[model samples]
Target chain A: MRREGSPFKGLSVVAFKEAADHMASPRMHLVMLLVILTAIGSIYGAIGQIKETVGQDPFLFLRLFTTARDPLPSFMAFLGFLLPLIGIALGFDAVNGEYSRRTMSRILSQPIYRDALLAGKFLGALMVIAICLVTLWLMISGMGILLLGLPPSGEEVLRSFAFLLTSLVYSGVWLAASMLFSTLFRAPATSALAALTLWLVLTLFWGMLAPLAAGAFVPIDPFDPSTAVHQAEIAHALARLSPSTLFGEVTLALLNPATRALGIIFYSQLQGAVMGAPLPFGQSAILIWPQLASLIAGMLVVYTIAYLSFQRQEIRA
Target chain B: MSTPVIEARGLSKRYGPAIAVDALDLTVMKGEVFGLLGPNGAGKTTTILLLLGLTEPTEGSVKVLGRDPLREPLVVKSRVGYLPDAVGFYDHMSAWENLAYTARLAGLEQQDATRRIAAALERVRLPHVAQKRVSTFSRGMRQRLGIADLLVKGCELAILDEPTSGLDPQSTQELLELIGTLAREGMTIVLSSHLLSMVQSVCSRVALFHQGKVGLVGKVSELAGKVLGGSYVIELEAEGCDVPAVARTVEGVSQASRLSNGAVRVDARSDVRGALAAAIVAAGGELKRLSMDRSSLDEVYVRYFEQVDHAA
Candidate 1:
């Protein structure tokens, strides 16, 4: 018999083939249509917002381009809450579908390394999502240019680029999460449901409970207004354990130039943003440094667990 | 020296408490059809998976093409083709598309991939169904597609696990012929099957697997000679049910019984047909059906397994 060599040198082709299949699949088409409609609608509405405002602060008018704290929470927080869920949806079934097909064993039988397989798949999925994100960012920027008579200033573009990177990294957390779930679970439906449930927990349930739990651990009562502020700060820090909080905090930093303190929320009023002395993006990154590290760390931890589990699993199926 | 294509030393696999494959030593030489005949859950698939490096064994060593499968899976896998017991595939892709994708994954160039896929499909007699969706294909068609995939793999050793299983008789015959063709081309194939007749027809060397071990192993001709012990079946005409009486008059008679079709069936320890034929006429029985049906692989396999089971 001939001495066999590595047969899976064409992993890139496999990745490309899978990505093409994803594009052809009905679900991806629906996802594309939904994202397109939302982007177009957001662009039209932003144009509408620019046309109607009068006598507003120049900073406040500029603020539409960069987020600032107001009666509503920061702009970045909302995007943070939504974008990762989209990432999760894109990846949740990536591994489990192969398991269901009884093809995972056949794939593992090939000469390619396990990490190569995951890397190819991750890069493929990332490319697909990046296509969507770039289109949305371009639309937002174009609308700002045409309607608001503002091509984003140099500083604004820098922050927006940083924001895009942060968003991608933040989405990496979800991709890592969903891939881990796919490996852990045998069924595609279960992997999907589990990812959705985790998204709900981070975005909705954790938002409500983690702060409240932290508040309960505090020594002070809220009836004392001045003291309550101190207690709520502790609650907010504990609440940031979930990715939603880090996303909320980081988006706030990227979107609102006036919103300073690196992302440390000191005020008791969760809805109210701290009106602090303006700080540079460098300083702001320093403040939000811990949260970003946590997000990156979270992704690594989950991926490591999934990789180990995948390596250990029998190829019986 | 020509190294054996596959060599295993005390190879065993245990799934938690259940022993899937016990300590076993095995080998398959280059350019031969080696068959492992056993029932389901008899470690046939486990053994195949081991060879592919899809699973790590609990004990012992498995070398495919002189490389440890677990340590150098890709090295071995690139030269080994496999057809699983149930030929499952992606439902969405057409047969040609699926074959092309696999070929691409197997590192074939675009032109070579195309050429190999078409040749494989044609070889499996699936040229017409090449463009059809795999989900729409019948079981036989899917089986053909699987063989096609293996063919396109261009491996020296083909490990086919129950390749013709669940196929109709005609398909089974066709599959056996396909194996024969591949074997003639000098591909070393290790085939596992529950179908005794199929294994017997296709495999030059057969191993009787029982309870995670090989109960018996030898060439079919050698085992047949050993089992029959110079015995040959003789068919002759007899009056109704008096076939036994004519057989009793024959010298060197070992066993005799009347067949369902009214022909006296006799198994002798030696060439007693000449004596048996004379005895039939002397006993007023006319010889009508006289044919020598060699003892089949089915009987040899059953006898081997049963004897092993009894000893255990």
Candidate 2:
């Protein structure tokens, strides 16, 4: 039977309630604090490095994110590494926590479909992540101007804004993945562990597993010289299967304006091209458009799976 | 006759190969406190889910207030308030905040929601703890807050699943009284519980669930009369002269037997204490005690199930 009424009738109500809960949580506070402290440390380190090579680079403002001193990773690198953790932490118990707390049935009993509840939760956490990323971006930019004694070019500002948007999407991918696990597992602790396990596998071990899987799929032939290139290409394709790899490529293209290509370039393809010359913001955006699309697609795909499972799940705790 | 607030015909739900609710039929009328009495996994909760359209039945149909719950769930859900079995709240939030969240979900406006929330808390007697976090609330307080949540939504029908399962006796009594007040104020209620005595005290009518089927459904008194063969039992303690024979002579007496304590147990169609006392006195039997036994729900449930078990 076709269901009457809009599935999104209570969407905003659920989203606002969930977002307020996220903002008030101690867990969110701790994550935001960690991000802020790291932002400050990384900006401080980048300023020292930029001062040492002052006047040597045209894109001095962009260097604030890419440059790093010893003992502290660059801001861009830290975000690439920590964004997934932040997303996972915020969403690991999104659905199952309601079950464990015995609130799922009551909430479901309201005049709303499961679509509203699951979508609201994902969007609510995604909104918080966006807010946090925007705040961090503003802080870093503000610190860079204060310490570097220069204003960023309009193009630089736009590129960094794109970078912030990419980071938000990247975090969303992990958030959706964690929520999928939360929907699958009943215990909050089990879901947390499952999400963390996936994170560890994708972040720490995916780089190594990519080549092994590729090599198995396309064995390197000793007789053919070009097979090595083919093998490397397959490896690269396999590695990009991980969301972290897609996010890392997007980060590289946005933060490093001179990035012209994400994959291996043949000598003929680089003919007459000036190396190390910065590409326009639009060109850089075009370069990572596919990567950005993949990030968004990955997020939506994971979220849709979570949505389907949650809809079919029994509401009794 | 009162119009039915809920109606189900041949409703059945199956999870894979296992039947959770088997071909069931039930009806609850407006402003009546109806109880679903059963043990765990006897399909009471499953029936509530089906009525609310949280789960689709494998077969059959159900309607709430003349609307098909499966097709028009929002309308049905808006009218029907549910307090789930072992109901839970967002513990970190204050009780008022929790109710306000549900009120918003119910589409109540700001001013209206605030007023309703205050009145609901007052009704449930939790106005003093309105701002206190629910994490500190006792189980009974939380259950009461659950009721307040239903009240704030202004639902016409309130379905409570095991509302008094874990409450202490005092809290149970208080909650039952609150449920009574809701019924008096013209709310149709469907309460599901495994506890017999609690349901007996408040419910106007009940359905006894056994193995995914309702073995019996009717007014408690009527069921007792049908199942136990008599609605009232009298115990007479007397000295001398054929007490059972004397008790049997009274009007409305259905059966009379002698117990080991030198007392006559008389099953009667109604309260026969005065008539039996006079009869015993005239029979020249010295009476020590004459008391009418209250037919409890426990006996009806047990006796009905025992017959089913024996037949099976």
Candidate 3:
């Protein structure tokens, strides 16, 4: 059966208005400043290291994202750490703030349904994140050319673009998470703290805890190397539960084409594979397709939870 | 009479264990200003929410403009405008921007929205501050802008929840006048407030909500007559004799009492001014001053609430 008007009737107007608000908000400015400063610092340090050690390398541009100074991590690593914070900042007040301000009822009283409002907010935050990531990518690439006096190859540019898209999706996962918390909590501060706490645990401690859990689940015989491999495989699977791990693996595969696999491999599996030979762009993309799909799926799943909750919520607020 | 613009049949709402509204039956006619008057937690706001389809009814149904609001909310909401109690707006946005946003949400074209927004602001007497952010606006200004928002939407029925709650006397009068103008322009209005005098001046009919159920519903004058047993009170000042004893003998006089000022106050079923004055003169008292008093809405409101309290 067909419905009369689209559920998303007012989506574009709401999205545009919300996107403008997000861009002009002080919270967004502060987070964007921090991300840019760290990104530039990491890229500058990577340039210095590349000049000293890999001056003649054909894929020198790729090192800008993967290389790290003694004290600082790579540009991609900084992004993997900081992007979720930005996402959380943008979304932690999405629903609750409207209620606290007493605007939710007035907005809902309009001709649109709750679907438009939720979709508009998510899309608006996503658009802002996409814009920030794309701009930062361009700035880093531009600085690479200016400082190194060498332009990136077409393949390097394509890979970096793919990395940027992956970063956008990675941030979307956190955005959806914070939006969910916003719906669950009545206070904006509570929602922000909740999202930030979950992010801290998943990004900083999940890797360490995954191994312990995996070892408990699949105990390895100390004398059997094959059992140790099985334990390692299980630990790897557990670690991938955190979106950060999935994002890190995708970044690694995209930015460093010579890397073949994310998990343990047998000697027979590597016999015919070319060592140190970068895979083609299509192969690299296919290699990380599952990881990309998982990130997108994670975002959709969290957003769907938020959407259903918002629809069920009373309109008194 | 014309068809009722708003109709609720056994409408009820319960939040968890507490019943906010219980089996409300109400009908508001076209172009008439209906008032919902009650104290806090009396379910006036809950009934308005149900009528607007903002909250779902637990056990009954509501229809706005002949369509079930729950079944087709968008269609109903498109034609109905609601100004919630303590109305809120995007503080950072200008009044024009706020109204324009609503206009767009209501599906007006850009040119049409712009034109209507200007007119709406003018109608609310807020055109001078159209470009200023709502954060800088005073409370009265915000209330006027709320009206401007409804006007921009071209609502067929305007439901204002406590539109005059926090305003000063002047602002309250101004808002009531604006509401009167809207009703005169043929828009049906449902105004919910605890201010009985305000409702008396503007609403043609009202429903008194007590403990989540409507205790009384009728025209204000009709209610005064029905509940108080009389609509008019006659007072006579005399100098020589017992005026209260004589006024009590007049036809249609329900009760008579003498005040300290030597005025006999008589509650009568109808106009008994001539009879009251002649009766006082015949009793050997010189009638000095005589006046007629109609029962105010305040008395009717208090009486209904008192009755409900006693029943509970």
lDDT of 1 by residue, B1-312 (tens): 156998988989998899988987888899879999888888888988888888878899988998887776676777888777766788899999988877877778899988999899999898998888888987788878887888888988888878887889888888889889999998899999988888888888887777788767789878867765666667777563377876876788788887788777788777787787777677776677666654678667667767776888
TM-score of 3: 0.93
Evaluate all candidate structures by whole-model CA lDDT and list the values in order. 0.75, 0.90, 0.90
Residues B1-312, model 3: lDDT tens digits: 398999999998999999999999999999999999899889998898898777889998888999887777789889999998888889888999999888988889999899999999999899999999999998899999999999989999999999999899999999999999999999999999999899999999999898899988999988988777775777778878777778778888888998887677888888888998887688788889888643678888888778777887
DockQ of each: 0.44, 0.82, 0.54
Give the per-residue lDDT of model 3 (tens digit) for A1-317.
23346798899988988899999988899999999999889999998898889335668888999999979999888999998998899999999999987888888889888889999999998999999998998898899999998799999999999999999999999999999999999999999999999999999999999999988999999888889999999999999999999999999999999989888888899998889898988998998999999999999999999998888888774
Q: Give RMSD (Å) of candidate 1 vs. truth.
A: 4.3
Off by over 4 Å in 1: A1-10, A55-82, A146-149, A216-234, A262-279, B225-241, B258-294
Candidate 2 A-chain TM-score = 0.97
Screening candidate 3 with a backbone cut-off below 3 angstroms (N, C-alpha, C), the clashing residue pairs are: none
TM-score per prediction, in order, is 0.87, 0.96, 0.93
Q: State how far residue B161 of model 1 sits from its true place (Å).
A: 1.7
Q: Provide candidate 1's TM-score on chain A.
A: 0.82
Q: Of the candidates numbered 1 and 2, which has the greater DockQ value?
A: 2
| Best-fitting candidate, scored by TM-score | 2
1 or 2, greater by lDDT: 2
- State which candidate has the highest lDDT: 2
- Ranking of models by TM-score: 2, 3, 1
- DockQ winner among the candidates? 2
Distance from true position, residue B310, model 2, in Å? 0.4
